[model samples]
Target: MAKTTLSLLPLILCLLYISGTAASANFIKASCSATAYPAVCVQSLSVFATTIQKSPRQLAQTALSVSLARAQSTKSFVTKLTKFKGLKAREYEAIKDCLEEMGDTVDRLSKSVLELKRVGKARGPDFLWHLSNVDTWVSAAITDGNTCMDGFAGRAMDGRIKTSIRARVTNVAQVTSNALALINQFAAKY
Candidate 1:
């Protein structure tokens, strides 16, 4: 009986782990449903389910982290595109302006992530202030993304460059928008 019990232990543990992971994933899926871009939110964040679990704070932080990562990568890609020739003067200028906006976006998102880490430790009015700061920074980050695209908004903007930049910027913005939605849900529950 002891031998049989020992042999079953590992199998039981494995099953438990699988079930826990599934539960976490389910939590993420349901939480993402509240976002503006549920599909993007789930796709980008589902991989971090184990870390996020069912905690609203964790979910919000993870979403902000994901958005920051996407913003950083998109900024890098746009920077690389600047090295190529054939872009119109205005297009080049727009890219430069966008790089600045992306920088601001990254900085704001970083601040929000750090601020959220403190929200759990804060109480009453302090908690509200920290959460409000996170919300404000995230909203500003969204605006930074939109402002980047605005630099290229005229008829003379090169189509190919415009198309590529717009797509990437729009994606990051959408992802950030989802993060904001998650943050709002977190706030509401508080």
Candidate 2:
């Protein structure tokens, strides 16, 4: 009987693991459904399912981290674009402003991530206050991305440069938007 029980242990553990995984996926899907870019949210976050494990706070933190990474990558791409020669003076100026905005976006997202880490320990009003700070910083980050894209507007900017920068910034903005939505959901439930 002991031998039989020991043999069954692996099977029981496997079943538990499978159930946990499905629950995580289902939780992510449900949380993402409330986001502005639900598909992007799910695709970007599904890999962290095991870690998130149906917790709203974990989901929000992971979303913020993903958004921060995207912002940093987009900022680097814009920085590289600035080195191109023969750009119109207007185009160069636009690139300069965009780089600054992206820098600000990265800063705001970083702060939001840090604040989110603190939300776990706070109680009562403190939790709400920390969550509010995260919400404000994330919203500011989204604004910065939009501001970067705005610099590329009109026919004065190089078509390719404008298109590429706008595309990348738009993607970051959407990711940030999803993060903000997740944060709001977390706040509501908490």
Q: List the lowest-lDDT window of 10 residues for candidate 1.
A: 81-90
Write candidate 2's Cα lDDT for 72-185 as tens digits.
999999899889999888888889999999999999999999999999999999998998899888999989988887777776665999999988898899999999999999
* Predictions in order: lDDT: 0.90, 0.92
Instruction: Indicate which candidate wins on lDDT.
Output: 2
What TM-score do all the candidates reach, one by one? 0.95, 0.93
For model 1, residues 1-190, the per-residue Cα lDDT tens digits are: 9999999999999998889889989988998898888999999988998898788888998999999999999889889978878877777889999999999999999999999999989999999999999989999999998999999987888588889889988889988999999988888898
Residue pairs of candidate 1 with colliding backbone atoms: none
Worst ten in a row by lDDT for model 2: 149-158
